[model samples]
Target: MSETPTHTRVREQMNLSNAVYEAIDTPTASGEHAHKVILRDCLGTLAVALENSYKFGCASDATHSRMLGHFAQNGLTTNNITYAPYPEYRAYARNIRRTKPKLYSAPDAALAEVFAAYGDIARATWDTQGNPEPDSRHAVHVTALAAPYALREYPDLDASLVSSYSLVHDILEWHAGDTPTLNLSTQGHVEKETKEAEALELFCTTFSPEYPKLVTLVTDYEELVNDEAKYVKTFDKLDPGFTHFGNKGKAIKELGIDSPETFWREHHNTYVRMSRYALDFPRILEDRDTRAQMIEELAWPSAQ
Candidate 1:
């Protein structure tokens, strides 16, 4: 196994807080604040690592570009120095998998060992996509720790992209299952239904005075979906909040008018509004006076 890198050690320290785990489990108005703190700490460490790498000139720009290309190919990001087309990178990755099967094969190795290797690759890939100059030692250590599970589950998949996607999904999943009003009538489905109901309720109540505007936003989103317009391009550029609130608005429209409520109840958890609000709420709360005013505003019933 590759020696764990020092930066990876630092990252582990950054992410090792029990408070983060506890905060994730507990839902409160302050949950967003907790998440931001964690994200800021993690990203800050990464930034430091990148700066160190730059100072040392250990890794070349070409290497960084290649790593970024790998990320972009995997639907991770498109902001790399190369800015290589995603499809091209995807094709290259596919070709490499097909042509160099030995690079991924683990003949005669224990399943655990193979899995560990895969997890390491996934972690490296995640860091590469997230930042070109991730703390080298830290990234290596993280990848080493994470590789085994990823390899065990998806021997053929790109472990890094899969890991990245999983991280994003897990963050989004936390907002589910809190409110009983949103819980689906159906049994055995994911608990996202409950979360969706809560979000819809929040949007309706919080923006009640703006119902006409909400309806219009929903209508536009539905139209864009039906017409198969680009997902990010379908909404008004003036207010991204409307676009976010309209997450899955296209899917909801397909259910037909008679079943709007039923459709919303069923798929509310799948919408992006809650996730966006959760992420953005921290920034909104950063201003001490503004946060105080918001607390006051939110304390009152929606009718007010």
Candidate 2:
């Protein structure tokens, strides 16, 4: 018997994820070159996984098959190409079925705008330092992709609102791009902030009347106002941290970060900055502790 389309899609999605999962373990020579190769491979794997998961969730069987075929053909060619679902697939999937309507409303114009704005915005991480074309997923999509898993720890929070917050938390960054400003001077920070603020104002004015809650969620996320928004913010930090950890901190180690304290304090400062929020929500705190211990163990495995 032939496999059903749903089964085919599930298998393909797992294949995409497992390809990266296995690639991560392949040994390589140690050096800057090796780190660059590892970073590139990891980012590529993440991009494939994120895109595959999204297409599997939304695309019609025919559309997905076409996409899969295109990707497979490209894999056979020497011409450099990145696999991506067509825009028509996304627009057509506007009416697709959703398990959580609140978190994912069908035929939502505001949500459509959010998705379009973030479609190609590559996130800036330590791993993507000098690459002209980093295969990184956008923060907007990251939030939506991570919502189901992240919300499991915070059962008390409103999943809908928190998921909504995750969807739009980085909506303001739509126009400005995800430029890492860690070493930027005060004036530079002010300029970037101003640009982002203008972008937010424009977004809110365009969609606020129709999507007041979404706009409010974006505002709350920027201000760290409420528990739901704060949770999304924390998850934002953890999402990338998890990516780094999955890649075995190659990016961090390449940046000369050798200790857990430095990793927590410098690169992924999610826990350091949001520890206060964890105090108010012990589940968040517990999750932090668990992850922190994992990082510590990863850093000093001999001690374990």
Candidate 3:
């Protein structure tokens, strides 16, 4: 049978969406060309695509609109996506794989290498997306480290399983780089998920022999078929919010989110996504909101 109207519209949307990624994958030009200029081009492509997709009445029209709202309210000039230094991490992984024999003989050295690789992968700042400072900025390893501490509240869950899921949940980012929850179009999200899966396969084939359990842990976390995965997932969502509130909305201010309207408009999408966790971890959800309230009411001087 011929394609349905829905399929045709979605195909068109995908073409537009793919263009956004194509613009990103394009190399920066030589000589005095600012890299930020490339991001402008990418967003411009994304804007046209989203506008057309919304007009076609795609299922994600609201999501598309909110994404644009996020950029608009937060400041159109903002650079949200950051990438890790290319080939550097790839080289490091290769080096680790080469020395796997020696590392295998010395368990401490092997573990250290794993932690070191993870330590180099940075988390996103409150304002932007991607992994900019893999060496210095917010490290994702902190989320793994904090998992056990957060486990105290959920006393009945399997601590060992939770810990395992946390440690490996973001391991693929060592190669894939961190993709923020809010920064991408639906197609952009799909491309990121594909890239991350490819990275995970690389890890399993190259490094899993040395770190055998890694494949299981990463896969289980992705599948999220157990309480352990769900528990770890809750922490993953909360970690950034924890950092945001702990820093007293410092980054939010840097993004010029001085008003409640701007702050909520930018954050409303994330808050709605986080609300689901209330089913499994009510306290975690409550903590997120309580802290958010403080930021909205007290952190913004103009709001106060």
Candidate 4:
């Protein structure tokens, strides 16, 4: 089937990102070089992020062929002229799928993290050292920044579909990870009060009112995800997942849930709901006349 105009647009973006990545030069090591490289790297994978993220009407198989074709064309066999793979199809298609968010949301989480890291880089209080070092923060940002468009696009996002706030929620607040004042990932143990609910609360507090539906959805999601965080905290004494956290399956077991499959049923259902809501934002959040006033009313105090 001929690619839809929407998919074509995605393709154009993909090509553009590839061009930017290939053409962008990393200047002599310096903060300025680092910033340019950072933005360049972000544009580099935005193609795939857009591919997986942009849904037309409702989540469906409409983009599956194009997704596969995109990967096939970008793979090693394509012998394309681009120096680096624009959309590493293999990476995107690691798991065949009927929809984008059905199987995994990590890429979404990962992409969100990329953006969050952008905020981090922006918010980072530089050390006494003269220039910012392209350290782990830059590495994590770049790593997540590079992604190919994914397996079958999520079913067409329709009115019935609800977008997910997970990525947006997660990207905003972090756990014992990188922060503006500290490198939690490397040396901070400020795990007190930092949990999924804490994360959701921060996002909810930050973005709600301006986005009431967002507040409602996450307010509900907090009830579900909060337990996972509690379990993670309980098991903090043991380094199970090497995530400094325990697995959800184990969390369920400890909680006496029916089974892993049952837990995932809830997980994926919520995932689908969240995905739909997120997908619909383009249509929903189109006008800022209301949002502007709403944001002004509830905008973070420090934001102004």
Candidate 2 lDDT tens digits, 81-199: 11121222233223222321122223245545445545335554433233321222333223323333333334466544554455456656667766554334458668888888888
Flag regions of model 2 displaced more than 4 Å: 1-114, 126-152, 181-192, 209-213, 253-261, 267-272, 275-278, 292-304
Candidate 4: C-alpha RMSD to true structure equals 19.1
Candidate 3 local distance difference test against the native: 0.45
Give the runs in model 1 whose Cα sits over 4 Å from its true position: 1-147, 173-191, 194-304
lDDT of each: 0.27, 0.44, 0.45, 0.31
lDDT of 1 by residue, 36-108 (tens): 3222222222222223333211211222233333333333332332212123333434433322111111112
Compared to the true structure, candidate 1 yields what TM-score? Answer: 0.20
**Cα-based lDDT at residue 175, candidate 4:** 37
Rank ordering of all candidates by TM-score, starting from the highest: 3, 2, 4, 1
Ranking by lDDT: 3, 2, 4, 1
Which scores greater on TM-score, model 3 or model 4? 3
* List of clashing residue pairs for candidate 3: 80-129
Model 3 alpha-carbon drift over 4 Å, by segment: 1-104, 107-115, 126-151, 182-184, 245-247, 253-258, 271-278
The C-alpha TM-scores of every prediction are: 0.20, 0.51, 0.53, 0.27
Cα error of candidate 3 at position 143, Å: 5.5
Candidate 4's error at 125, in angstroms? 13
